[model samples]
Target: MSIEVGSKLQGKVTGITKFGAFVELPGGSTGLVHISEVADNYVKDINEYLTVGDQVTVKVINVEKDGKIGLSIKKAKDNPKPSSNRRKSNTHSKGNQDRTETFEAKMNRFLKDSEDRLATLRKHTESKRGGRGAKKG
Candidate 1:
């Protein structure tokens, strides 16, 4: 089978490097699967995911004009349905109980929080600035 962009093919890992892994595809063609394309999450070391002679399914992401092939292992796998257990963050929703609180009370709370944040920021910036060439250590 010819290797084309978006095609999923089985390949045998021939080498592994810090950056990526080399896989030998069908018809004796080789492709490089970059570290970033190796997994869905961060990949610090390619050895953790792949090893020499390991068989992996890879997706053809690109074919350079110079005949270089870019492959991806993560994209080759079927995408799993999104989990229902994901935590949906409602950052702005103060909730039904907070609705009972008086508008004045909410305003006061916000103002207090804002003032406290401003004070902390001022302190941090002043410490860093050190005010008028204050003793470089």
Candidate 2:
């Protein structure tokens, strides 16, 4: 019943908040499972994933000297699912060498694109003449 760092334990959700959920562990000790530790993917709402009285298996990531315990639900899983909700970068590839651009080349392209966008914006704003002279009624 003793909670230690790196130990996995089942706990009950005592309270839920925007930041994290308070879990009541064995031996009447409580731990805070941060929103980020609640899931492998982005947790926009902790309530959506956990609620008061919900049972969860958490891994003890840390037990602070001040008696604060940090727990992680994602690490407690035997096989965690990879988070695919994140946007994948199209600029780089592991096996595709042909599409890879050098750092200098990429910087040059970015600068050129930025310059072009600024030039286009300037041309657009300059062509405008105060929206028909403020539309005098």
Candidate 3:
């Protein structure tokens, strides 16, 4: 089988490492599956998802001129898990049935949150430094 970019194929997991996994392609070509490509969510450990000698479907995402191949196991899956950042509609609100936040409102909330975080960080830093401009008694 011709191993080209975007080509999907079944490969065996020959090795697993902290960064990624190595898969042996049909034509004896090996490819590296980066940790980010292992799944849709953050992959703290690759061993949690893949093991040596496991048959996994992979997509050929890149092929270097030096015979290096890059694969993605997440893309090979039919239905990947949705990102955690996608927020669901707020159904608990009783007053606003069809109310949607405007750009200005969202920006206001973001700014407020950022300000709060910065204040907290500044407070912590000041406390650690024994208060700003305080002369040691």
- Which of 1 and 3 is the better model by lDDT? 3
- Which residue pairs show collisions in model 2? none
Q: Write the per-residue lDDT of candidate 3 for residues 21-136, one digit (tens) a residue.
A: 99999989899999999987779989999999999999999999988999999989887655532332343433453346788887887899999999999999999988877756
Tens-digit lDDT track of model 2 for 2-92: 6799999999999998899999999999999999999878789898899899999999999999999999999999987654323233434
Q: Give the whole-model CA lDDT for all candidates, comma-separated.
A: 0.84, 0.85, 0.87
Worst 10 residues of 1 by lDDT: 82-91
TM-score to native of every candidate shown: 0.63, 0.66, 0.78
Best by lDDT: 3
lDDT of 1 by residue, 6-120 (tens): 9989999999988999999999999999998998766898898899999999999999999899999988889822232121222235444443567798789899999999999
Per-residue lDDT, model 2, residue 116, is 100
Please say which candidate is ahead in TM-score: 2 or 3.
Answer: 3
Ranking by TM-score: 3, 2, 1
TM-score attained by model 1: 0.63
How much is 68 displaced in model 2, in angstroms?
0.9
Q: Pairing residues by index, what is the TM-score of model 3?
A: 0.78
